[model samples]
Target: MSDPNGPTVRRRRLGGELRRLREHAGHDQAAAAAHLECSTSKISRLETGQGLAKAMEIRSLLDLYGVTDESERAKILKLHKNAAEVGWWEQAEFEEILPSGLGVYVGLEYDARAVQEWGLGFVSGLLQTEEYARAVFASLPLRPQDEIERLVKVRMQRQKRLTQANGPLELWAVIDEPVLRRPIGGPAVMRAQLKALAESAAQQNITVQVYPANKDVHPGLRGSFSLLEFGPADPRIGYVDSPSGNAFLEKDKQVRALVATFDRLRAGALDPEESATLLNTLAAEEN
Candidate 1:
């Protein structure tokens, strides 16, 4: 739950700049590593934003890359400094659960100016109520009760971003029809959840659309995916989370594919007003 300019995002921006500089200088990882007296893997990790670069190390890399522009060098150095700051998710409470790429995903979500999500089997996490989220986690066999609570807490905390008045993250969600019909956490929980979802969709920054079950097969049948947008400078990120694994799509081609899929899904889905009406109708049925 880091703020917009979180460390993870800064690391990515800096890493991208470094990679660009190196490529422009015609230096591969091997050459850069030799210049810095570090292993190639270290260079790779920094370029991938998986590892932070120390100021001295960044300076050495800049020097090696033949970066003569003082202002550009200063900007890169500032990125390094900002990326070194500790993120809120690094707190002791989340250490155990965040080892997976969820930490990075959360950071990106916080820093994102907007997000587009397609939910195939369940409601989007950003729209889930506390009880609905708790039930979803508790359903996992043999999961500790404490762990379920922590997961729910993390989900609820993420929703707070939607409520922030200053530049609240714009959310566009496309939900499959079956997801709304499934009585997660029993009918009562779903009833409340649906009502809440409709209210959320009513907000200025949030848009909700439903893909009817009656339609022919669509791209979303492949699975759920999300696109996180950080405006022009940073690359758009495509995200996929499933039981098998989680993937963050950073390459332009991969992100573009996800974008195409989402656009198709949105085209086939109900309009926002109709989606809200359907949610209300379904919620009423649960009573």
Candidate 2:
């Protein structure tokens, strides 16, 4: 019931802890609600992360559960406060332009520690230059002009998660050769995009791999997907998106399969050094 990959991330964690405490106290939902002077449904919503849990209500629950440890109480209160805070994606700036599923994905990506992504058709969003992102958004058959601009803004903003002052997020991206050659936004745009990719590959936190066009068909032919490994502070999430929308895969089994697939793709794709050389050579050809 806890969705750790959305705006309610902290709320989800708080809810889980509240539920755990309730169970440990041997209090049923009805009992806990009676003690808090609220409806059982309210308690249920809070426990499932479908609704926010207030710090006052949390304190009441703690007392009801006989939890005396100050540290535990402090931790739960902090989580409650964080749960109530708004995420960047939830702000009005992107409200209408961002799709719900994609919003949740952005929230998850915001907290990711490392990302392993496979791109079969185009540059992955994080690696795409502003020009490339603009071209990609503009190419959508029926998308409105304003919407394209907003989408581009969202992608560019999302890239910031990789360069934050603290240990930046690690990105391992494998792009199929055809995508690199596809001339997404024309030669000039492609050249700039390739140059940007090479530059990013030079950075310590980013890994760029090109799956050669001449190599035998590989696992990525199935589709594009990303495995987002979250820091210990958050739950790990996997993302898969298509023309319609995006989906999150949080189950251990499903996530493991995606991880294995990525390992195979990495094994099959060019090493970073070779990929850097190829990207540079491709950019030179575009001149």
Candidate 3:
């Protein structure tokens, strides 16, 4: 689906093609940059999709690589135009306040075709209700009330992807028992949140699983992570947040490991059907 990550994904796609063309022509990054009279960093950025390339710039590089095919050239040029478009978050003034790491994930999340998340803390951001979200944000102790509210607003806006016009983004989330049991925002908020969780799990595109806390050892004990699957043409993105630090994994090896891990977790956790029953039970127990 076309989403906030459109521009970023486009740049990366365009960059990959340029990189392939350069390599096939036997001109390394430095050589290509020298030939094009641009800095090597710019060449690097363009090939890695870290920055946008202008139409003229792309054409020039194509010409240098001897790409004379009109159709291929047109396709690449189209990518440039699409890449220049910005998503709603990018247009917001408050975007500057979001952490760079979080900002990157949020962009990717919006464009993802589906998200597979394992939550060890509270529920995944996509599943967080407004009151639950507010309470969780308030506990952070870093941002002021207004800033926290702004962050909450952003989270709420992002949830729209699950029910937006094009189609809902598929969600397969596995929550540990404690996640459903914990009363983050007090009994009322927790009860509503779990009720919402049960309802969300019922959606066709969403799958909710529960991992038992009694498991002696499990794949998820390593840590909580999320794997975002985008269009088949795009690479998968993996994210891990822990006390150690946060990382957004893009390399194939890193992503593959996380994907395998999530798979194992899904396999071990209670299936959506049983999970819904567990969720409802927990919600009813809340005061």
Candidate 4:
């Protein structure tokens, strides 16, 4: 049940807290719903940040789950109040209910001290050129041109955080070799994109690596993911996106596994110096 109203940042935060409470209590959707006298589907929706949980309902659920810590209770209650607040994105008519995990993505991006990403099929949104972004959006059927432009602009805005005067985000990204070879909007657009990437890589806060097809082995072959290291305010979080939606790996075991995989992949990928050489070589070919 996607909410046409869209989720507010507060609602997203509450949803995340609810999920943590349920997981900590060892209760699945059915069990939690039974305790709350609601349908399991509703519980699932609330946990995923797709819908809001009534404050009273959240209170009852927390009490029933034996969550006794006063500090924790206040935090969850505060989140419920916050979810009622609106965000700037909500002002846009084209706003759709982004997956619940997307809230986590935004939250982490805002708070992360560092971020590492790897992409296999296309350029990561943070680094995508306007033409590249347009081409990617064009692949979707029936999107209004206005909405496409809005999205592109929104994406460009996100890059500002990386260039802010105060401590900008420390970003490291690696792309598969095929990503460079495929002309997203044709040679002209790709040439510019490659050149842009090469230039951006020179920034002290940014590191770009390339994993060539000839690499003997790499853990990234499993799929693309990101590891966001937060400041003391929050713990590290890992994210994996798929066509259906996204998943957050927060549990120690899962986060560790993904981190290990990323480490292995990084070791196998081209070093920064070598990767720059590869980028320059490809850019020359395009010219």
The per-residue C-alpha lDDT of model 1 at residue 207 equals 99
Instruction: Single out the weakest 10-residue window by summed lDDT for candidate 2.
Output: 1-10
Number of clashes in model 2? 0
TM-score of each: 0.90, 0.79, 0.85, 0.79
Tens-place lDDT per residue, model 1, 1-287, is 22556787788878888999999999999999998888999898798776887799999999988887899899999889989987666666775765387877887888889999999988999999999999888888888888888888888888888998778888999999999999999999999999999999999999999999999978899999999988666788999998888998888899999999999999999999999999999999999
Better of 1 and 2 by lDDT: 1
The 10 consecutive residues of candidate 4 with the worst lDDT sum are 1-10
Candidate 4 RMSD to the correct structure: 5.2
Number of the top TM-score candidate: 1
Tally clashes: model 1.
0
TM-score attained by model 1:
0.90
What RMSD, rounded to one decimal, does every model reach?
2.5, 4.9, 3.0, 5.2
3 or 4, greater by lDDT:
3
Best by lDDT: 1
Segments of candidate 2 deviating more than 4 angstroms: 1-9, 18-77, 233-235
Instruction: Show the lowest summed lDDT stretch of 10 residues, model 1.
Output: 1-10
Q: Give the poorly placed runs of model 1, Cα more than 4 Å off.
A: 1-4, 31-42, 67-72
How do the residues 208-280 of candidate 4 rate in per-residue lDDT, one tens digit apiece?
9998898766778778899987545345778998877788777889999988987877777899989888988
Query: Least lDDT summed over 10 consecutive residues: which range in candidate 3?
Result: 1-10
The regions of model 4 sitting more than 4 angstroms off are 1-37, 44-51, 62-75, 83-85, 89-91, 97-104
> What's the candidate order when arranged by decreasing lDDT?
1, 3, 2, 4
